[model samples]
Target: MTTTSVGAPKPTRHTADSEGPRRSVRRRSLGDLRVALIFVAPALLGFVLFYLVPTIRGIYLSFTDYSILGNPIWVGVKNYVKIFQDKLFWNAMGVTLEYVLLNIAFQTVIAVGLALLMYHVAKSTLIRGILLMPYLVANVIVALLWFWMLDYQIGIVNQVLQWMGMPRVAFFGNEFWAIPTVAFVNVWRHMGYTALLIFAGLQAIPGHLYEVANLDGASRWQTFWKITMPLLRPVLLLVMVVTITGSFQIFDTVAVTTQGGPINASRVIQYYIYERAFSQQDFGYGSALSVILFVILAVVAFLQMKFLRGNENDLD
Candidate 1:
């Protein structure tokens, strides 16, 4: 009986080597995660402190009877009820909707048209630069310039009307003209930015598509309608959504030009909220109105995303 003591099988060198690399990879992955967290910490902290905390506090304050000077007292939905009953609130809502629709329609049309023009004049750097100049000017400066241009007595617009043998109209004074005048100014101030965005989308589209369309003997209008418009749908949708939200939040123009005047014709939801919070010192009501605005914006953005998502798939 030659019983040779069997030595324990030596651990496989290859297995040991594989274990080392796996351990190294795991360690590297953990290290990378830690670094990413470190880089994101500041932004996370700022978002929580500035946006999340304020949003939560505002929502809480909306259901209370709070003023600037006093502690918030629970009041259930009285603020919301009052908002529903207030005639001014309804009027402001109607004005806000009108402004939103007008701005969206006009801005989309002008911006898309300008973007199409810019696409064609892509070789002209000077033209593109000139087109973009208005977007760079400060809002206040633009408002002031327009103020001078639309002044009732000394304005260039009225002067031009007189020169053209038309009656000198009060652009910002008359109730009928006030809202439209402000809308025009808003359009002028923002159209360049919107057009630039759409232009970027147009440039991203492959030039080969246009070449193919031309080879197929497609006319310029046909090519634009079938190719450019469809390809730029995402950008157009984004611009429309942003314009709608901004229109709903119309304030600076109304403040600087009309002051929500000519019988509050230009008083949008934002102006109403400002008055409730600052002028009347009713913080709770203002917060309630803000919450309502937030809800509307959220719904609009969601619907826009849903609509655009379908188009995106089609494009893909």
Candidate 2:
């Protein structure tokens, strides 16, 4: 209700002008959200249908007796109670632990050493490609290849051992050597990939720190201990979590090479679960075993992250 002279400026609807851009911005935001959802829909759907649904179904099946031939009968905690009294379960657990320890110990140390060598000596793409080739091969193929190569009768390894004046040892046949031989095969297959992971971590470390250490007259060993190890802890934590979990779920190599032979020598927990669920048609017991493994892995991961301070770095 204000009058304006001809020479004076005209009043503009600032509120209306502001609202036009606001509405445009809101429309743009909604359009972007739609695009994002469209992109994410496939993976989200996969997670819900495959992972989430199977996990829930498995948990429920753990409480019921589902033999696939008949309807599931709810047995409450009976499967779990049976698992507690199962000596085979305990033996599988112990054997799996031995495999995990052997695999992790050799794999981590060798991977770190290879990473260091790659970082310092040969940082070539060709070398890295050759190292990664074993990992690219299928697990079954790798296991079978190693199985034949380590065969006691006419295998290359045994031939070399005999040439060296040592008796040909049963790499996969004997109970004492079965688990270790299986562990070694997996270690050889996976170390290259693990080395690349550690190599990436090494690349992240600041080079200037090493230079400063050199200026301070620090020995190579001292620099590695003080600088490299501290900064590398986070990456090591990640490597440990991944490798240890995968090691616990060892089945393919054992299935191919040993088949849990020589009196359950290499029967890992996963193999045991597979036998119960598939061979014996005891889904409830298998599911209960799977749940126990899940709990163990969860606790182990939590402990590793907590103790290693995985989220925190000493780069400061």
Candidate 3:
């Protein structure tokens, strides 16, 4: 419908429809980006200030002899060397490793079991809240509650044991039982919390998958193994990573119940760090240990991520 010079007659023009949509989409994306940045800025700033900055500064301080009140003295790797040579450091590290392993085992198995039980039962808000009640309690309170429950003389647990004709044994007072007792208490407090997280993952699984499995006459065990466990890998890995970090850094329960007692048996890396940095005023060595712990957690988390991503590709 356009007119032009005779030589340029019939020159074609493209419609604006396609280009218009592309431009509109770009504008909308930019708008969304701006909104996202605005919303995340406060949290991002807090994280950088509180966590990232401290982490970087702490790592730098690990190579220096630092006391909070004085300027840091350049110590190179002297602190690290001392930590490596210290027998108590290795003992604490061993205890931390054992705690992490036991916690991961208990938390993973018990959480998964409880999650499965919840998934099968009638879904009720009350039930969910009750399950998570212990997790909501403060760490100190959880420790105190378990401490009383496991007390040798006046504790209900020992009384019940006595009723069953079993001898009453001191849990935290014995070096051999101290670590396991604290680990068990931690599991009891956190099992429901982890289970609820896993339950949410269980809920996300498509119902049609189960229906198809049912139609194929798959046994419950086979369906659970073949379908549920595979689909739940990501969530399980998340729980494992978190629980491992927490176990390695456990402090409140040990402080309240055992105080790393009976022979420093229940002393974890976090408590060790605390005693060194604050109580004994050995900031440099503490920072070195902190760096070591950070490295350990980073390696574990990276491994978990690698495994999770590998499963994703396989699942796809």
Local distance difference test, per candidate? 0.82, 0.89, 0.84
Residue lDDT tens for model 3, 103-146:
88988899999899899984787887898999999999998998
Q: Please give the lDDT score for candidate 3.
A: 0.84
Pick the winner on TM-score between candidates 1 and 3: 1
Among these predicted structures, which one has the highest lDDT? 2
TM-score of each: 0.88, 0.90, 0.86
Quality of model 2 by C-alpha lDDT:
0.89
Error of 3 at 134 (Å): 0.6
Per-residue lDDT of candidate 2, residues 1-316 (tens digit): 0121211222123333555666665656556556656676787778779977888889999999989789889999999999999999999999999999999999999999999999999879999889988999999999999999999998999999999999999999999999999999999999999999999999999999999999999999999899988889999989999999999999999999888888889888999999999999999889999999999999999999998898997876
Say which candidate scores most in TM-score.
2
lDDT of 1 at 94: 89
Which tens-of-lDDT digit does each residue in 1-316 have in candidate 1? 0111111112233344566666665566556555655676687678779988999999999999888798999999999999999999999998888888787789889988888888885559898888778779977788778988999899998899999999988888887888788888888988888989999998888899999999999999999899988888887887777777778898887777777778878888898899899899899999999999999899988898896772572356
Q: How many residue pairs collide in each prediction?
A: 0, 0, 0
